[model samples]
Target: MYTIPKTSTTDMEVTSIRLEKELKDRLKKLANNKGYQALIRDILWTYVQQKSGDYQPQLSNSDIRASLPATAQQEERCVLTGKVIRPSEGMLLGLTNNGDMVPLSIDSLED
Candidate 1:
């Protein structure tokens, strides 16, 4: 839920990348008042944090608002226990406080 901040945009170097016009338009629509560049930065940060070995999302069972049963369409990692959920495995999709649905091991909620 929280991450270590590397540095502010003030200390960052600028780099350019090209995107399809339609994609850029969609991003603009979604970004709204925050602006597309900031949105892009946020998306990159989320991806990097998820892939980082040291990243442990600051979440708890209490932070999960609900748990909905689901099946893994592809391999997924349980957010609570960091266990691999293979394709077709029965699992639970925990809806977090922030309204994100994350995979959970089948027995994560079991006593």
Candidate 2:
């Protein structure tokens, strides 16, 4: 295992991030010798990548919340079968000739 010398590195000012209790517990449990700071840095870097469109991180609660389109409370239905499907979840459900309604993720839906 590689070791980083504890010789005091140059200090950088850090702003406080308020992680939820559940997230904190999970991070503390998963952290290794590299520790919580490393994990936090990696997480922030991933978010940066996502913001810059350089990388596609797995969708998170923040991403979903931010991407949500304005909508109203009304039942939506399939034009063919008249089956109720919620638009908030942004599903792509379709029935084949065999009459199987296959549900697809929003990202997979092609324009």
Candidate 3:
């Protein structure tokens, strides 16, 4: 036997933003092809989560340290903190604080 948890639902105020002509045209097309309101709702949800700094992917420490292809690793810095990123890509391997070398992905940093 399994039990399910109950959750509470809350009401939210909806606000609209004025999009530029080009963007609005594209959005209108997308909404017509798909459900516009649903598309907008998903976009808004992601935007709000990112703005609130509450967005986190469920990943473990070992998951974060997975190997990258010989390519992809690159030096990156924390945008908010500006700390130097160790080399994870390139011919040279990055030395971790624990003295372990890890491959870094330059492309992943852009994301």
Better model by lDDT: candidate 2 vs candidate 3: 2
Candidate 1 regions exceeding 4 Å error are 18-39, 52-55
Global lDDT scores for all candidate models: 0.80, 0.47, 0.45
lDDT measured at residue 27 in model 2 versus the true structure, 0 to 100: 88
Cα displacement (Å) at residue 83, model 1: 2.1
TM-score of every candidate relative to the true structure: 0.66, 0.38, 0.34
Clashes of 2: 0
Positional deviation of residue 12's Cα in model 1 after best superposition, in angstroms: 2.4
Residue 35 miss distance in model 1 (angstroms): 6.8
Q: Write the per-residue lDDT of candidate 2 for residues 43-95, one digit (tens) a residue.
A: 67655653454543232222221222223234443323323445565544444
Q: Name the top TM-score candidate.
A: 1
Ranking by TM-score: 1, 2, 3
**Candidate 2, poorest ten consecutive residues by summed lDDT:** 59-68
The positional error of residue 106 in candidate 3, measured at the CA in angstroms, is 7.6
Give the least accurate 10-residue stretch of model 1, judged by summed lDDT.
49-58
